[model samples]
Target: MVKDEYTLVLVKPDGVKTRHIGEIITRIERKGYKIEALKMIQPTEELLRQHYADKVDKPFFPELLEYMTEGPIVGIVVSGTNVIKAIHNMAGATNPVEAEWGTIRGDYGREWPDGNLRNIVHTSDEPSSATKEIKIWFPEFEFTQG
Candidate 1:
């Protein structure tokens, strides 16, 4: 799994508003990864609809969509060895309350309006997901070596 790899990294609205963009990017780069593509965009309802479409029928879907569209987010494509799994480990659990101390979620998140945990980041959960998400968020951008 050491071959060239890429994963999507998002600096959620909270992260961006809190100025954690630089810190998050530093963490990834310090781990020997390269950022391939990046953008700051306010996602549309349709965009969020497609991105989390799988969770559309879930109980938390509405709130999640609203939260995502609340403000601008930094969407990025990062490349390196085992980047998908690496990013997931760095992001930690979905529930910040249960996330490990050193992970991004644990350090920056708190419970949200609906009593659900409001982690400040999102990482693709698998290789297939990474591919799908990167395409969804950065369709025009292509991965290249740094």
Candidate 2:
């Protein structure tokens, strides 16, 4: 039997600036996933640092941080069987150039002249990351036992 799985999806700053939030949500709903929770937040440096701890020390982290903080982002908790992997696939490749034409990033993302890749969304790569990330964006949320 298929079990309900949850994942975190962040429509990053670029996506918000470009006003694609509605379209993104429509796509997610079209996939038959339930949006359990959603909120728009202007992320703090502390919050981003916690969420991107693994990438904090990377060379381009500052650029990434700046891009993320440029505007408010929409955080969504989506639930469905295999939603984590499915959403990741829907988000497309990290680089829009490498993403498939129909995926979110491929359709709405682009590499800026500054060399930053403005991917439209961020989805948890796995269940553990989803749990960790969901807390970062939705601290008040009650987690499932699964």
Candidate 3:
């Protein structure tokens, strides 16, 4: 088992403004995942650009970045067994309309007719993404040795 494996979870701007942070935390806890560290942040432009570098060329990327910076986000380091995949499943799809009913996005998020995706949460895609996202979001954080 991969003990202490962690994933980066971002309760996005919409989630924060909607006061869904508590429910999100509750669900994470209910799933038996541990929150190692958490904070609210207003991400800088450079940080987000780097984080979403791959999408920079896409037309919708600007709106995506703008939406992310609209409000403060709750960033958390969540530890659990196979958290990368497990958390992804719990978060559901990026588009709430297509997400499964029980998942976070499906349950709490809404779909806008203007084609904007208002998904409430974002999780690291895999181990590599988790590592990169952790570094981007929490550079000063040091992992304690077991």
Q: Please report the candidate that would top lDDT against the real structure.
A: 2
lDDT of each: 0.85, 0.94, 0.88
Model 1 per-residue lDDT tens digits across residues 7-54: 998888888888889989889999999888889988888888778979
For model 3 the local lDDT of residue 13 reads 94
lDDT of 3 by residue, 3-82 (tens): 66779999999999999999999999999988989999997889898788888899999789888998999999888788
Measure candidate 1: CA RMSD.
1.9
| Candidate 3 to truth, TM | 0.94
Models sorted by TM-score, best on top: 2, 3, 1
- Per-residue accuracy of model 2 over 9-106 as CA lDDT, tens digit each: 99999999999999999999999999999999998899999999999999999998998899999999999999999999999999998999999999
lDDT score, residue 68, model 2?
A: 89
TM-score of each: 0.92, 0.97, 0.94
Q: Residue 89, candidate 2: how far off, in angstroms? A: 0.4
**Model 3 bad stretches (over 4 Å):** none
Worst 10 residues of 2 by lDDT: 137-146
